[model samples]
Target: MPELPEVETVRRTLNELVTGKTISSVTVKLPRIIQRPAEPEVFAQALAGQTIESVERRGKFLRIRMNGLVMVSHLRMEGRYGVYQAHEPVELHTHVIFHFTDGTELRYKDVRQFGTMHLFQPGEELVQKPLMKLGIEPLSSEFTLKAMTDKLSRRTTKIKPLLLNQEYIVGLGNIYVDEALHSAGLHPERTADSLKPAEWKRLHEAIHETLERAVEAGGSSIKSYVNGQGEMGMFQHQLLVYGRKNEPCTRCGTPIDKFVVGGRGTHICSRCQRLPRVKKSSGEV
Candidate 1:
């Protein structure tokens, strides 16, 4: 799954590639991918002749803003978008195609067929299902240390899963969460409330710094992820712990470890991110 940085990269590339282009027609080969209007025809009809104003990203979703409608698209798993000339042969697994007036086409391909598209009137998108429950953007001005502290102070959930919850912090998935936790030198199993003030500060800084650097590097392409231009991300080469299990830690010589936390694969350096000791009952020991 592409995290915040990958999604943001796609948004930026789509904005450059598709904005201001009028949709001459739309073809939805996979009707199930269209979650809105109940019918693919309605979606195609609504988008016809509508000019794409811009492309924005909310968490892992791509918001393709048109004349009067906002098409919210979630590229779940292997879904990707690319622009090609009309004469180009449509590739395998291409589920959606937006034919532009200029003889070019914007194609959506998904190998897993798990991507989704929801159409909405401009303002309603913000108040509706997908976007409504998403939490603050880590890169935005609203994500302050105080804000993070306030949210985590009341939750007892383990830090890894807590950070992965879209309701609390959007755009984080297994990859980035592992990277962030490792960067912070915090154990994945640590309860949120167990964090001290200094630990909270470290976490807050780590999240921001990790995400910012990943975004700059175009996001880690650990899987099949690519930008709208079909470019691979370079951040994976800079990763410290996510896919480097059994390798020596960059911060310490400890071998990186991989285990399951909150049902997701987690990576950390045991020496750098030591779990807190638990007090045992007097008789149990």
Candidate 2:
């Protein structure tokens, strides 16, 4: 799944490619991918004749703003978007196509067929299902040290899963979570509430620094993720711990370890991120 950096890259590139273009028609070959208006033809008709005003992102969801409607799209695992000439042959797995007035088409392809699109009125989008429940954007100004610590204070769950929760901190997935924890020199198994103030501060800085660098590198292309231009990300080459299992740690010579945390494969440098001693309660063993 594409994390914040990857999603943000898609938003930037897609915005540049599609903004101001008018939708002449829409073809939804897979009706299940369209979740709004309760009907696929309604979605198709609603988008027709509307001009794409902008493309924005909330967490990992892509918001394609039109004249009066907003198309909220979630590109689940293995989903990608591309712009091509209408004369070009539609590739396999292309489930949705928005034909533009300029003889170009914006195509959505998902191998897993797990991608989703919801259409909502412009002002009502945030009040609806998916976007309404998302937490603060980590890259936004609203996500402060106090905000992060406040959210962390309420959880006894393992720090890795807590960070992965979209309700707690939107846009973090498995890859970035592992990378952020490794960057902060914190163990994935550490309890969220066990973090000290210093640890929280370190984590806050690490999250921003890691995400900024990844966005600069167009996000990690660990899987099939690519930008609107179909270019793979460069950040995977600079990864510190994620997907480096059994490889020597960049800081220490210790081999990186891999294990499941919160049901997701997690990577870490044991020497850099030592496990926190399990604390016992007064009545417990």
Candidate 3:
């Protein structure tokens, strides 16, 4: 799944590619992807003749702002966007196409068919489902150390899963969460509320620094993710431990290890992310 940095890259690229273009027509080959208006035709009708003002992102969701309408899209797994001329052939698995008056076409393709689209009135999107429950942006000034510590101190869940929860902190998926935890030298299995003040500060800084560098590098292309121009991200070169299992740690020479934590694949360097040994309840030893 494309996390914050990847989705933000898509938004930036798409904004440059499609903004100010009027939607002359819309074709929805996969009606199931449309989650609003109760009908695919209504979605097409609402977008027709409307000019896209800008493309913004809230967490992993893309908001394509148009005249009086906001199209909220979530590219779940393999969803991607591309801009092409009308004369180009429509590729297979292209579920949605927005034809522009300028003869350019914006196409949405999803191999897994898990992507979703919802349309809502301009201001209503923030007050409704999907966007309403999302937490603060990690890159924004609103994500202060105090805010992060306060939120984590209230949760008993393991730090990794807590970080993955969008209700607590948005834009952290499996990949980025692992990267952030590794960068902070914090164990994923640590209790959320058990961190010391210094640990919380390091973790907070790691989250922002990791995400900022990732967004600058266009996000890690660990899977099929790419920008609107179909370019793979460069941040994968800077990854510390997300997919580097069995490889020597960049800092310590300890072999990176992989394990299942909270039912998600996790990577870590045992030497770097050392955790306190837990006391056994009542052992026969």
Candidate 4:
């Protein structure tokens, strides 16, 4: 799944490619991808003649602001968007295409078909099903140290899983979560509520730093991830932990370990991030 950095990259690229362009028509080859208005045909019809004014992201969802409506799109695993000339042949995976007035098109292709699009009225977008439930973005000013600490205080779930929850801290997925935890020298299985103030502070900084660095590197291109220009991300080359399983840890020379945490493949350095003592007392209590 595309995480915060990946989605942010996509948003930047799509904004440049599609904004201010008017939609002349829409073709939805896969009806199941449209989840709004209860009809796929309506999804296509509603987009016709509307101009894409701006592109914004809430967590993993992409919001394309049109004249009077907002189109919320969630690009699930392996989903991507591209801009093409009218003569460009659409890929076999391209399930949706938005024809523009100037002999151009914005195409959506998803191998898994898990991507979704929901069109809502101007002000009703955030109230709609997907975007309404999303939580604060980690990079936003509203996500403060106090906000993170308070949210962490309520959960006994593993730190990684709790961080993965979009409602708790939007835009973190497996790759970045692993990198953040590893960077903070924290174990993935550490209980969320057990985090000390210092630990939370470290985690917070690591999250910000990891994401900022990833965005700067254009996000990690683990596989098939690209910007609007069809270019691969450079962050993968700088990854400290993700996809480095069995490789030497950059800090401690220890072999990086990969394991499943909360059903997600997680990576960490055993030496740098020691396993939390299972029976350690909750020092706070």
- For each candidate in the order shown, give its overall lDDT on alpha carbons: 0.93, 0.93, 0.93, 0.90
> Which of the numbered candidates is closest to the native, going by highest TM-score?
1
How do the residues 131-230 of candidate 4 rate in per-residue lDDT, one tens digit apiece? Answer: 7787879999988989988877668998999999988899999999999999999999999888888989999999999999999999988888887788
Provide the RMSD of all predictions against the true structure, rounded to 1 decimal: 1.1, 1.5, 1.7, 2.6
- In terms of lDDT, the poorest run of 10 residues in model 1 is 147-156
Q: 154 in model 1: Cα distance from truth in Å?
A: 1.7
Clash pairs (backbone) in predicted model 1: none
Question: CA lDDT of 211 in candidate 1?
Answer: 94
Better of 1 and 4 by lDDT: 1
lDDT of 2 by residue, 1-285 (tens): 999999999999999999999999999999999988889999999989999999999999999999989999999998999999999999999999999999999999999999999999997999998899899899999889999988886688999989999998899999888888988999999998888989999999999999999999999898899999999999999998888889999999899999898889999999999996868989996
Off by over 4 Å in 2: 279-285
lDDT of 1 by residue, 1-285 (tens): 889999999999999999999999999999999999899999999999999999999999999999989999999989999999999999999999999999999999999999999999998999998899999899999899998878776789899999999988889999888888888889999999999999989898999999999999999898899998889999999999998889999987899999999898889999999998999978995
What's each prediction's TM-score? 0.98, 0.97, 0.97, 0.96
Model 3 stretches with alpha carbons more than 4 Å out: 279-285
